[model samples]
Every structure is written in structure tokens, then in C-alpha cells.
Target: MSENARVTKAAGVVGAATFLSRIFGFVRDVVIAWFFGAGLSSDAFFVAFRIPNLLRRLFAEGSLSIAFIPVFTEYLTHHGKEEAFHLARSAMRLLSIILVITAVLGVLLAPLIILMIAPGFTDSPEKYSLTVLLTRIMFPYIFFICLVALCMGILNVLGHFAAPALAPVCLNIAIIFSAFFISPYMADPVTGLAIGVLIGGALQLTLQLPFLIRKGFYFWEKAVIFHPGVKKIGILMLPAIFGASVYQLNILVGTLLASLLPEGSVSYLYYADRLVQFPLGIFAIATATAVLPSLSRQAAAKDFDALGNTFAHAMKLVFFITVPSMAGLI
Candidate 1:
């Protein structure tokens, strides 16, 4: 198929899968509201979840995928599949070690982190303690989800979009299952949601593994610790990480201010943000995800004309969908 057609087809697949995930996510939110309402537990859960969720976006899905894909695609286009796979394996090994250490530190520093993000929680000792506990419980999710993100980058480079796009549906399903099945039995019902986050992250990583293995990308293979591609990815990732961090810091500031508001203010903001994210995730992110591999290949091939056309096509598609959605929201 042609490049434009390929991009469109991939975007459609991703958008459809994201639509399903968002629907499930909406249901999950409704279940949470029904079970916990928008008070202390809900507020605490949102704050705790936000910390790791922010890190996930910053380090894993956003920066890591953005950096890894171009480099991985270049390796595939120029070097060969074997070289690309080696780079992926090397990245997987190194990332796993870093994520393990980060998770451990996040768990240990949950109190300090929570204090920095939501100082007003200190006013309510119970809320503060619960948020810290939940944060600790969910910190390990970062490890699983980041691995999933790496798998996603590799798969996308290999021309597989459906599995990666559908992975998030697993998360919403896990959370919904926890709300109905697990929370009732827990001493603190909100703790179940935290458990759900971990389960969802693991499930996402698990969902990607069979696909990766089928494509000959095995995690168990010996990896090069200091691969040159890994260094290049690291270099590309640093700036992206910084940009995401700045955006997240803005979010953290908002969360901090929200924590100081009325009891349900945090939950209110969280719900509104989710609503806004629905359209953005479905079209905007899907389009970008679909085009990345194509753009990377064109650049690798030094096909500047093709690259310009592909970039323009993606921009037009994004504007077509997002403009109307934004107007409707307004």
C-alpha cells in the first residue's frame, strides 16, 4: 500500500482501539464515582494515581516511545532487522533496571512526594496517610507500564498497531473489575483501585509480549549494555523528557492548588480532564502514533518530498478531527 494509505489505515485501527478503551475508561470512572463518590477517598486516589501516571507519560509512553521509534525505525531501514532488534533488547534490559530502582525509590519516598504534590493533604491526616499508602502501592505500576511502552514502540516500528492500541483497554477492564470484585473485600476500598493500577499495568505488558515474541523480539535474550543506538535514544530522549516534565509540573501545580480547594475539587478536575482527553486520545494521539514510523522511514531514506507530504497529511488529519471536537467542547 501507499504511504498515505498506510498511515490512514493504521490511524483508523488505533483510533478504533482507543475509542474502545476510552469507553471502558468512562465506565470505570462511573464505577469509581458510584463506589467511592467524590470525597476523601476519591480525591486521595486521584492524587496518588497522578504521581505515577505523570511519570508514565513523561518517561515511558511520551518521551521513550518518541525517542525510540525514530531510532529503531532508522536501524530497520538502514542497518537491518537484526540490528534493530539488538537495540530494542539492549534498551529493554537497561530500562528494566532503571525502572526497578525508580519504583523502589518512589515507594520509599511516597510520603515526601505526596507532601510536595499535595501539601494541603496534611490538613487531613487521614487523607494524607491514605494518599501516601496508595502512592506506595501504585508506584510499581511505573515499571510494568514503561516496559509496555517500549514494547509498543518496537511493535509500531514493525508495522503492528492494533495490539499496542488495544493494550489500554486492559487497564480500564482491570480497574472496573477491581471496583466491583476486589474493593468490597478490602479494608480500605480505595486500596483496591491502587491494586487495579498495578494489575492493569502488568496486563498491558503481558498483552504486548506474545506479539513481540511473534515478531522475533524476545526479552530473554542477552542484551548489549552499551549499545550505540541506546545512547542515541538516550540523547534524543533527554529533551523530550524535559519537555514532558515541564508540562507535568504544570499539572502538579494544578493538583496542588486543587488539593487546597473544597473536598471534591480534585476529583472534579480529574473527571473534567478525562473528558477532554477522550477526543485527544482517540484522534490526535492516534494520528501521531500512526505517522511516526512512516516519517522515520522517509527520513532514513532521505526522501524529503515524501516526508513533507506525510507530515502535511498528518497535520491536516489532526486539524480536521480536533478542530470540530474543540469547538464542540467550547
Candidate 2:
């Protein structure tokens, strides 16, 4: 098949898988709404959820994947799969260390972090305390979700799109179950959601492991920080993190600013952003996921012409799909 056709087909599979995941996500949100609604616990949970989620986008799937995939592809192309796996293992170790440290700091300083992000919460001690408590419960999610991103990056680069794209459904399923079943037994219902977030994150990562191992991917016993591939990924990820995490940062800054608005503003924007994210989660990510593997191949083969065409094709698809969808949502 032609390159364009191949990319389109791959993207279709990813888009479908992502669509299913989003449906489950929406169901999870509805379950939350049914139990929590737009109130103190809900708002607190939104803040709690957004913190780790922002980091997930920043370091895991968003910028990290963009930077990691190309460098990974480069390694895979010239060095072969074994060497590429070596690079992946080393990169995973470095990423895990950073995420674990950040997650720990986030948990330890949850109250302070909440104060900084949503200072207005201070006016209501109840909300403020709840946010901190939930943040502590959920902060470790950053580590798991980021690890999921790393695994997804490897799968995507290996041309296994469905596994990464579909993995999110596990998260949605876990949360749905937590909301319906686990929350009743918890001290606070929102705590159940927090527990679900942790479970979902781990599940997302674990679901991909067997498939990855079958493909010969394995974790490195120790992190090789000075590995050339690790260095290259770090160099690329620094700037790319800023670029890739733009959406998450935008919403986060917006959320912080919302603290100055009337109460419930944070939750309103949180839900609104989720609505926008639905389509983006579907088409934009699908396009990116499919393009990255093919684009990496073209670039690896020094086929700039094919690379340019692939990039253009992806942009065209994204624009054509997103413009109308965003307009309709608005």
C-alpha cells in the first residue's frame, strides 16, 4: 500500500480505539457526576486529578513521547531492535527516577501545592483540606501515568498502535467501578476515585507489558544515565516538553487563574476542558500516534520527501477533523 493509505489505515484503528476509550471516559465522568456533582468534593477532586494529569501530559505522553519516539526510532533504525531496546530501557529508568521523585515531592507538599494552584480554596477550609487530602492520594499517579506514556511510546514506535490507544479504557473502567462500588465503602467517595486513578494508571501500564515482552521489549536492570540515546532524548525532550505539554500547561494556568473567579469556576473549566479533550483525544492523538511511527521510519531512512508528505498529511487530517468538531462543541 501507499504510504498515505497505510498511515490513514493505522490512524483509523487508533482513532477507533481512542474513541472507545473516550466513551468509557465519558461514562466514568458521568458516574462521578452522579455521585459527586459540581460541589466541594468534585472541585477538590478536579484539582487533585489535574495536578498529576498535567505532569502526565508534560512528562509522559505529551512532550515526552514526541521527543522519545524520534530518538528511539533513530536508535532502532541504525542500531537494530536489541540496541533500541537498550536505549528504551535506559530511558525508562531515567524517566522512572524523575517521576518517582516528583510524585513523592507532590505527595509531601500537597497542601502547599494546592495553595499555590488554588489559593482561593483557602477561603473554605473544608475544600482546601479535601483538595490536599485527595492530592496526596492521587499524586503518585504521575509516576504510573508517565510510565504508561513511556510504554505507549515504545508500542507506538514499534507500530503497535491499538495497545497504546486502547489502554486508556482500562483507566476508565477502573474509575467507573470505583465510583459505583468502591466509594460506598470508602471514608469519602472521592477517595475511591483517587484509588481508582492509582489502579487505572498501573493497569494501563501492565496491560501493555505482555504485548511488549512478546515483541522483545524488557526493562533494563539499571538505568544507564550516560547512554548516548538517553542523552539525545533528554536534549530533545527539554524543549519538546514545553512544546508538547502546551495544552496541559494552558489549562493548568487557566485553572490557577480561575481560583480568582467565583467558586465552581475550576470545576466548570475542568469539565469544559474535558469536553474539548474528547475530540482531541480521539482524532489529534490518533493522527499523532499513527504519524510518529511512519514519520520516524522515513526520517530514519533519510527519506525527507516521504517525511514531509507524512507530516503534511497528518496536519491536514487533524485540521480537517478538529476545526469542525471544535466549532460544533463551542
lDDT string for model 2 (189-268, tens) is: 88999999999988998999998997888674454666888888888878877786666667778878887677778878
Residue 317 in candidate 1, Cα distance off native in Å = 0.6
lDDT for position 50 in model 2: 87
Those runs of model 2 whose alpha carbons end farther than 4 Å from true positions after fitting are 220-223
Tens digits of per-residue lDDT, candidate 1, 1-330, equal 989999999999999999999999999999999998899999999999998899899999769999999999999988998889999999999999999999999999999999999999999999999999999999999999999999999999899999999999999999999998899999999999999998999999999999999999877787787899999999999999988898788889999999999898899999999999999999999999999999999999999999999999999999999999999999
Mark the 10 consecutive residues where model 1 has the least summed lDDT: 217-226
Segments of candidate 1 deviating more than 4 angstroms: none
What is the TM-score (0 to 1) of candidate 1?
Answer: 0.99
Choose the strongest candidate by lDDT: 1
Instruction: State each model's CA lDDT, in order.
Output: 0.94, 0.87
Highest-TM-score candidate = 1
